[model samples]
Target: NAGVTQTPKFRILKIGQSMTLQCTQDMNHNYMYWYRQDPGMGLKLIYYSVGAGITDKGEVPNGYNVSRSTTEDFPLRLELAAPSQTSVYFCASRPRDNEQFFGPGTRLTVL
Candidate 1:
């Protein structure tokens, strides 16, 4: 899909606040992906980028924003963090002909 917006597009966070999920990888890779893993479940795609300055939404792009300003950095912005968004986030990078290399992941709790 091109874009997605929740019914209640904006909400003021009560306890949990916004955060920028940082994903780091080699400068040589051209593709990067972001995913979140909940308890006892598999990772769900949040966003991805083909190269610098190019990004697109993945399966679960809600409540998140991503930008690829440079090859070495792809940051996911968690907006109005909600409890549902609490999970361990994984960042993976891969070259055109190589398998993806994922980071340990960042644990985020929106509560």
Candidate 2:
């Protein structure tokens, strides 16, 4: 089974535009997360969901939103994209064991 998959591997957006990054997993995991990594920084969590219909913001969520409607999918929305939002976004999922499986990641550039 595919552990995790992300769509639109690369995107370039003008400032103020909006986009949604898609993530899906066939593992039936109970936890899903969205994270971003800047050019010189480590990955930072943006949002997470413990299960379906439950979602919460993480370290950085100002320019993004997320929803978990099913255990297999977690999509992150960027409203009014900004240059600061330009980063590589990754989606991850894991079961109760706490080992996370990450998606290949979507690289977004806001100019």
Q: For model 1, state the Cα shift of residue 18 in Å.
A: 0.9
lDDT of 1 at 3: 17
lDDT of 2: 0.95
RMSD per candidate (Å) reads 8.8, 0.6
Models 1 onward score TM values of 0.83, 0.98
Q: Which segments of model 2 are wrong by more than 4 Å?
A: none
lDDT by residue for model 2 (1-111), tens: 978999999999999999999999999999999999997899999999999999999999898988888889999999899999999999999998979999999999999
Q: After superposition, how far is residue 109 of candidate 1 from its true place, in Å?
A: 1.1
Residue 97 lDDT (model 1):
88
**Cα error of candidate 2 at position 34, Å:** 0.4
Model 1 — which ten-residue stretch has the worst lDDT? 1-10
Q: Write the per-residue lDDT of candidate 1 for residues 21-95, one digit (tens) a residue.
A: 776675478899988889888989999999999999999998899999998788888767788887778888888
Name the lDDT value of residue 16 in candidate 2.
Answer: 98
